[model samples]
Target: MSLSLKRFAVLLLALTPALIAARTEPAATLAPEANQAVTARMVYGLLSDSRYAYAPRQLDAALEEDILRRYIEALDREKLFFVASDIARFEGYAGKLAEAIKGAGLEPAYDIFNVYVQRVGERVAFARGLLDAGFDFTQDDEWRYGREEAPWAADTAELDALWTKSVKNDWLRLKLAGRDDEQIRTTLDKRYANLERRVRELRSDDAFQVFMNAYAGALDPHTSYLNPRAADNFMQAMSLSLEGIGAVLQRQEEYVVIREIVPGGPAGRSGQLQVGDRIAAVGQGRNGAMTDVVGWRIDEVVQLIRGRKGTDVRIEYLPADAGVDAPPRQVVITRDRVRMEEQAAKSKVLEIEDRRIGVIELPTFYLDFEGRRTNAADYASATRDVARILEQFKADGVDGVVMDLRSNGGGSLNEAIELTGLFIEQGPVVQVRDASKRTAVHGDSSGAVAWEGPLAVLVNRASASASEIFAAAIQDYGRGLVIGEQTFGKGTVQTLVDLDRFARNENQRFGQLKVTVQEFFRISGGSTQHRGVVPDISFPVTLDASEYGESTYDNALPYTEIQAVPYQRLGDFSALLPELDARHRARAAEDLEFRWFSEDVAKFRAERARKTVSLNEAERRADRARDEAQREQRQAERRAAGLALDEGAFDDDGLQADERNVVQDVARQKAAEDRPDPLLRESAAILVDAVDLLAADEGRLAARVLRPGRTSTVWAGGADR
Candidate 1:
């Protein structure tokens, strides 16, 4: 009976495909069924009243034009589905979406999305038909894997050829992976079917969210709209469910992009994934057949990823830092629950010659806001944990400190100020200004200094938000030397608003809107919005800032500066940077580890510069072999030198890759602990040089330590908290 039913269903799909599509139905059904008009008005009203909004106003003709362009781009980012005629048709709605939204009408958004849905069905069908015939890979050809910047197809004929090549490329990838023709065909058939099926599954709410994000994202990339399910997922994460890979995924084009890696999670701990990487496919267990997830809804992909603890889930992802045309890499992650303890600030003392430099590795700036508000004595927070670590460091007779904020995606604003207070007695930490120029200076008022010795703050591309606040404050006060690559430029603040609260229907779930409300600046008068914090002693920047950072967004808030607040300088660290930099460069030149790292980065960048890949099976095999050889060679050299190899977290000995072993997890942590951190070691060495430099200069450090910062006109909430 089941086989008969399946056959009947296939016959039904083949005969009446239009019945499955909403666009072919009556026009009234095409419009959103929910209260999108009310929701859109509520969003606009909130942004309009906010003084810090970068793009709040009655939607003018210019904004309308931008919205229309953005809306279409969101629908077809790769320009594969939409042809010239389709875009030409959409241009008629240009500069008019504002009036439609203002009048509580969303038909225009629906119209565009309906067309996109139809186009996706057409493309998926085209791809499936091409797959049946297969391709002769004997002919030499190249597939343009990167097409975000490609021009739209002039006609359907142009689109057909593009899809032909695309499908051919897909077949070649599987064939090279050693799959039989029958297996490859089955996988491709399922993938194409899923693509079309998921598009059919999309509802009015999904379409509304996409349109709303396009509207909000025009002003700033961080501003976005979350549907009811998405909002619930976000709240669950905030409450710390800690299941799955524990990464925040956002939709971009057809892919689910990694936005943030949750601290203490398998993904963050293993470093197998990074922000901006897009998940292309997912599979279960150690070697389950991969299911193509491209164009699947964000929530659906997430559902596939969420699984039982200690089980393996394989993820195929396009790495963010890997340049265009890079092949997707597969990783098998053993799921584990994230413990809050792992996210807490940790400290260890590094012995450099005759002195001890305390290193505090802060994975994130976490604070239990409700706990703190209720005066819970044991509320978990970054500042409190770091304060305790500092006390321990003092007891250990540590000469200097390194606040390692590497990969520290920031948290509470109040915790940043409190954390800054640990090093400096009292001073302005950050300056925030609104749209109409209402500025508020947040500072630390506590008359307590945890560590007054020479300090260095280690940062990288991932350090952001509150991390920037502390690092910038330390730099402004001359309290510490900011070391490593430039910090992630994300100095904007956002407030989440529940749209349902303002809706007339109490039962209607209008979802949530995350709007940018304020942009903060360093106390030294520069905003870390686009131009992140530059280090006093610089390291070779491995991640390209243009590809990462806030600058990558289309209309991110521009970097600006306000008045510098009054803050006492700790010492003349700037005056000594020249010599300090000189000494750092000299030492790094001869350092074997640093040289190896630099060489690796150079090779990676060179590979990333390519634009296309050969479709020939032989060439593709050679490429994969070369990549594997390079990776194995690096691990071999590290093993030879008795260094730790980055084999990910769950490199199980006896059990399958998917099976969880608590004992193995502990062992892996031990191995990681013993791994030599070349960057931290170098930072400690620099701090040692600074300690000696100050001591030799006779009371320079002492004089710098004596000066305490003065009070400032602070904000209402942050400084005190």
Candidate 2:
């Protein structure tokens, strides 16, 4: 139901049996369909040992089939804002699938088609019902493809089909806005014809996605299979820029749909190109003849439009309207690279009530791989830049700093150690354990301490890998405070092994598996595996906790405790915890709607736990009714709390106000417990308090300041990965 990465990953892997059948039961009930287990030894032997043959490990057909089945089942588990009836229909297809997989002949496909047609009929009926019920699905943000890369070119037809389906889906949401059944049916008829023609011309999403899997799986999973044009676009994405009018386009039937005009780029600068416009024709330069691009492969169409920077490219487009009477418009745009500067790390100083705290939002720890190959600065450059910003903040006398690592996917491992070292005097940053149980402790070999201030590491459901390691180490060493949601529970380390290294011939191509070998552990005792790196201070943000952690993944390793390493505490901040708790409670009480939402979400969970799918039409209708009733009950409760009774009300945009409230709440809590945070207000306050305590105890700070390591020179024997 939720689109958490953990849930989607399970869906992507498709290795869980229950996922294949739209069931949530344990896999033991299904036949023992697992492939031979992928072991650390097998992976290692393939990489390091020479005894093994240079071949990808082979699996039996049954196992491969099981993998696909499980993968599909897993995808269905996320609920993904799919219409409940569509979901029911999808499950209904599973029966036909089971029969088809077990049996043979056109009779199976014919029977499946009968069920499929009925499902389509039901879809049309439900679309009308939603219209009658006053729902507006199209406007729902969930309809937008969330944060994934643009779909490649082979998927043009699929994209078109989705656009067509989305039109109907969106109409259903709109229909819920007090429309009569007559009007609804009329709208549905138009949508049905559009969808029918589009669907017939395009491949089914299931088949298309399956083909994608095979194609991508053939290469390295990271190296995707894009159509010739999507391939060009993919190259641009890697370079962090793109040319050709700077508009993200998609193929919708005969139309090349404009998804978004890149902000500040050519199309954006043109002040004419708009999102949701379709290019029916294109012309190069100012005087070239207009070439009809309708039905052309998206790439061929793009070539017709692309030209030198600052050169004009004309696009003949129709505005995105399902209505037939809309006229086409011509717009001219120049070509330029769209720079993604927004994704770069940004710094700000927050005046949290009385406390002044510095916040560094690290979106992603990115390293320019190409730049690094050319011996240009990499993550080190970014870190150095951030350090300069921190130094400036220090000069401004901010109390503490919050390194906002939320949603930060990992980058260079080298940077992780270096960043950790920046805050502490030379010591082991993290202890990495390998398959042989050999412990390798990576230390801050750099003797300099760039920042010695009180630190607060902020993370959430999306914080992962290097983020987890750094947070865990800081918590373990008592160097900083970890605030906000738990870090993503990905404790395993992956080493990219070139599959070609073991390939038997020039054409010996095999996909690489990002095999997990070593696991990470806190210096204290715990491994951030299934349990993840839990914050010392916990705050609730999202309702779908079960949807986002290592526990949600079937193949994830379990958490365990390790022997604690002896490490010095940075300073004592534990005394402030009680006051911090009190302040948080006081702030949470003022947010009445947030409180009500929490209660309603709990009820939704209970409802979800009680739901089951069946094939009978009457039973399915009853289930739909139950779901609608539950939704109505939730709405009534929200209305009682004085919240608006809008259908698509609980959106991220609406949630921003609540997020601000929560931020304010946190600010208050931090202020109550500590001084103004440049790194961590609570930590700084604790530092101030410690300064007083140490002064009273007679100059302990001078005695505890760590000295440099015994030796600083590098050895001739080896270099690190």
Candidates' C-alpha lDDT: 0.74, 0.50
lDDT of 1 by residue, 70-98 (tens): 88888778788899999899888876688
Summed backbone clashes in each candidate are 1, 28
Best-matching candidate per TM-score: 1
Instruction: Compose the digit string of candidate 2's lDDT tens values, residues 1-721.
Output: 1111110000011223352232221211111111101111223344333222212223334333443334333332232223334434444443333233232221322332333334343343333234334433323222333212233223334434433444443343324334454654444444443333332333222222332333223222222222223434444443444456777666544466676566778778778766667788888866778988775656667777776766788788876653324677888776764555555667887655445667787776554445557885342234665678788887987755778887786655556677777677777777777766667777686677766655678877788878888888777666666776777787766554434343443432332333345666777767887667777666554424476666776535667677877766554446545555565545545545444445555755554544322223344335455656765776787578685553442211111111122334334444543421222333333333333333443433323431222111010000010
In terms of lDDT, the poorest run of 10 residues in model 1 is: 1-10
Candidate 1: give the clashing pairs. 51-435
Taking all chains together, each candidate's TM-score versus the true structure is: 0.74, 0.59
Shift of residue 348 alpha carbon in model 2, Å: 3.1
Cα error of candidate 1 at position 137, Å:
4.3
